[model samples]
Target: MPSVLEIRWIMRPASLLVVVAAACVGEPDSSPWSVADSAGVRVVEIAVEPVALPVYASVGELEFTVGSIDGTDGPAFGDVGEVRSLPGGDVLVTESRSQTVGVYDRSGRTLARMGGRGDGPGEFRFLHVAGVAGDTLWIWDPIPQRLTPLSRSGRVWPVVTFEHELADRPGDLRRLADGGFVARTRFQPLDPLDPKYAESKVWTDSLVLRRLDAEGLEIDTIAIAAAEQLLREIWPSPTGEGDGRPVGAMLPFGTQAHWAIDSIGNSVVVDGTSGQMVLRDVRGSIRTVVRFASPPRPLPEAEVERLRRSRLDDVESSPFRPMVERVFSKELLPTAFPRVGGLLVGESGTIWVAQYATFPEEVTEWTAFAPDGEPLGRLSLPARFQAREFGEAYVLGAHTDEFGVQRVQRYRLERP
Candidate 1:
């Protein structure tokens, strides 16, 4: 009988096999499965349908150009978490590794670096995310699990820490129209013996979206099981070792995934690994699955049987194994890519999606789309950029290496 490695090689398409083999560089059995070619790329040929409201043009382009923003010494600004725009055209950036939120002007010059890694009044143990509302800046520190509010003038207020049952780790915080803010909490791992095998086994677990009032009280919650199922269906399952145990089960993965809320409180949750996005209406009863991609084809029955009979050691050390891991790695896995990277819902119900692409040098680009899912233009930048919203402006938080020094750049959009 042929070995499991041989069977996997035979099942993979010729074109994909060559690509995988090249990536493996003579390594044994590294390739897993070939993803659908159509996955990850944008949907370009869908027919437009009429809705209750008018369908306006929803596509725009992003003309992003890199700028010089110097503040802080080398190694000061680390990996960026969130880039938020203030009311007066300034941008606030959370340096997760450096434990500081660097404030910058619209032109990319740093004005201030707020807070460090500490437990003091203004300090943050771990800065996970950030947002801006009027003159206030909200930073989420997961270690302390509190929201640290800072004034534009750099005065720190008493932290808003919620009860553990309300939210263990805060995801994203957005300002509401009613002077309150909405906070999102991710799903936690249930008891290992729980019957929900799939939820507990997956690295990126499902998430639960919760709305918080000004007093940090939980006002509402949205179950994301449907979204999780949808994403799993879209991405190929990691290789199952003997006894059919998935490799991802042992790896640490993020659970917050992606989330966004509109002016009317409608929420869109994205599970990139599953290629599924769930849109929940304000009433919560209205849930719709937005399918963006398809998973790789499964192995044939004969091939499956061959793999089952193959020796464990021979299979584990095969070149095809690395290929499988590479195909499923977040970088190459088509299902792991987000359909729309940075999503924002406008007050007028205009849904804007930033198509994000990241390259090896930390370069990133974002393409904008209208609320009706129309393609807008694209934004290209030289650094890593994450989307943030503040009132009418769209903020792009970026991290770049300038002559061996790390810097943060805030790019704000002036919508026409």
Candidate 2:
């Protein structure tokens, strides 16, 4: 079967990859960290101190908020997609529901609203603030599929269109510190009769990571990792023989992997099994493998069943209910809890890895590592706050209240 792939090139020319030594370049420091070389790759194994680092004394002082129950002053945002701090105390917010970017002042006043629902240069069908590169604001729209650069004042620049080659959808477009872009596209067989899955009841779904220059041109393919291991239940064809329809579902709490690229285009891959983070440099070379003392926690069967039942209840009225039931009939709970829930790279090149929270009431604590793979400390955000960007002196994110009202808020970072 034929597949589609869309590739585009925009801003900046490709530069040379700065090569680091293929062997261990530094000696082990006095900390609980050790340095080693594994197959010519440097490894920094950090034995995180058992005594948990104290959480921040306080989250921070409230700076400003830019959403409300009524749209009188500012946007009564239905869904706030992204929030980033701008120079001189301004905030950039992407209101996805309205398909626009709203620039707000420090006092929660709307400065300017950019873009609306459209396919034109300044408009966006599915708008997201990809990242900020100096004075340029990157807006990503996977619907019409292009990257639009805008000034801090919301002035639109040349748009880079994703020209269709093969049919895979590219999304998660993020800007690297070197002024390039990284995106992810997933591949899985939708047709049961796909040649690769013809004789297999189990199919592997994979993720493709591609690097692009500032102009949206392909730089190099980074890595392809298994996104999911799906089990397919084949429904026979009209003749009741070959080429049956395959209905697939993943096992609950299965081990999965996630990745994030930092400012310098260095990538970190987090494997759910061990939770160890493998860091690769801009040239896609393994620079270090960051390990800590934390181990995977055991998940309780009761909680597992509760979650499984909750999932079933969600799809109870859907046509795929039977498939979901079949997927859950085998008690597919994981042996241990997932180690890393999510990962982020701060604006200052700090790697923030969110340790999986067991309960909804538990505040998620993130372990921070310096750009060089040294453990910095632990940081926590306000409960229910989704952090989208960080600054030298503040955290920029969205917080949804109990009334389901979303607000873009910034809090001052209190330094010791």
Candidate 3:
């Protein structure tokens, strides 16, 4: 395993970062778990047994909620991007509709509001509260392609800009342990002149995750994983004046790659086909592989049909609704559910993997693994609650009411 060791230079005028490869100290385990050394790298393989019981039945104590539909307190968020709990009882929320970040107390009272709809240094076009580093919060704006630092007291710091190529619609922005960041460049534009572009229904490619320093400079290129397959159909323009436009969404029930950044700045990738997870360091070296023994469950046809109908209803108001309807069908759905749905790494370095759920009425199962790859058992929560951040004692999530009003909710993490 390679460990980072900072050493000051005696003769040189500047400091240099060095990585030292350490020798493996532990012995290999038998059958279910094993450790091996390959090409100067330590690899730990864990074969996890199927967990039968959940650690918690419901983790909902409802510590606090901040939002409303009546617009009574100006906290009526239109499209909430992210939520993070502060050091005290304050909660930071990002609303893309207003391009604002609102800080609220535990009682849902607004403490401070920052940013607005503009392209200025402090303003935002598509604002998202990415993560917090010490007393500063990092805000991601993909439209103008920049990361703006905001203080807890609503102070705006110097903005960090990115190159146009690197900032063109990146995926998730994860904060590193050393105050850096990693952004995943998800898609590659299709060539319009290519014959395959007109004939292909599903396009598959690789996604590149780039690592940037705290100053927003590209420092290293991280791992490349399979991108989500696009399910699209070519539709002629409504005006019938130009080339056909490709209208589609990510393929439902398709096997793709899901990843999360650990507390120590390592990247963990897992393909949805199975319960295998690959852990790599910042230099993109495979350090470990965690695999669960359970196989994928068979997906019911009725459930697939239900999901298709739900997706069609979501795009009912779109102009490409007809093309989307043609793209979503039972035949296009996978026969078995993806073993891994999503991945989340807690602030304590504990890894949580969520099970795939097709509907809100279903129960979402999350299995936690230690930093060393030991299974910590599973937990269950309502599918309606979308968890944004998970800590040892609490989970911050977004809950939508029956009237479609968004609310930031903090729930106590209850375990047996």
Estimate the Cα RMSD of every predicted model relative to the unseen true structure. Answer: 16.6, 8.5, 7.6
lDDT tens digits by residue: candidate 2, 69-144 = 8988677888888777876778888877779888888777887778988877799887767777777888888887
The local lDDT score (0 to 100) that residue 240 gets in candidate 2 is 77
Better of 1 and 3 by TM-score: 3
For each candidate, how many residue pairs have backbone atoms clashing (under 3 Å)?
32, 16, 0
**Tens-digit lDDT track of model 1 for 1-416:** 54222233344336534654574566433422112223333232211211111222221334232233343332245466666556676666676676887666655565766888888888988775445667777777766767888887778888887653564456556655554556655567534333454332343455666666667677777545522321221122356433233233212112225677664456766553443445555544334454432332332444333323442334587634543343233432332333333455544444444433322233244433333232233444434444444233344445445464444443445532
Full-model lDDT, candidate 3: 0.70
Candidate 2 global CA lDDT score: 0.68
For candidate 1, the TM-score is: 0.57
Q: Each model's C-alpha lDDT? A: 0.48, 0.68, 0.70
**Stretch of 10 with least lDDT, candidate 1:** 45-54
Between candidates 2 and 3, name the one with more favorable lDDT: 3
Candidate 1 wrong stretches, greater than 4 Å: 1-76, 107-110, 128-130, 167-172, 192-204, 226-256, 285-289, 293-369, 372-395, 399-416
The best-first sequence of candidates by lDDT reads: 3, 2, 1
* Candidate 1 accuracy as lDDT: 0.48
User: Candidate 3: deviation at residue 122, Å?
Assistant: 3.7
RMSD of 3: 7.6
User: lDDT: which is higher, 1 or 2?
Assistant: 2
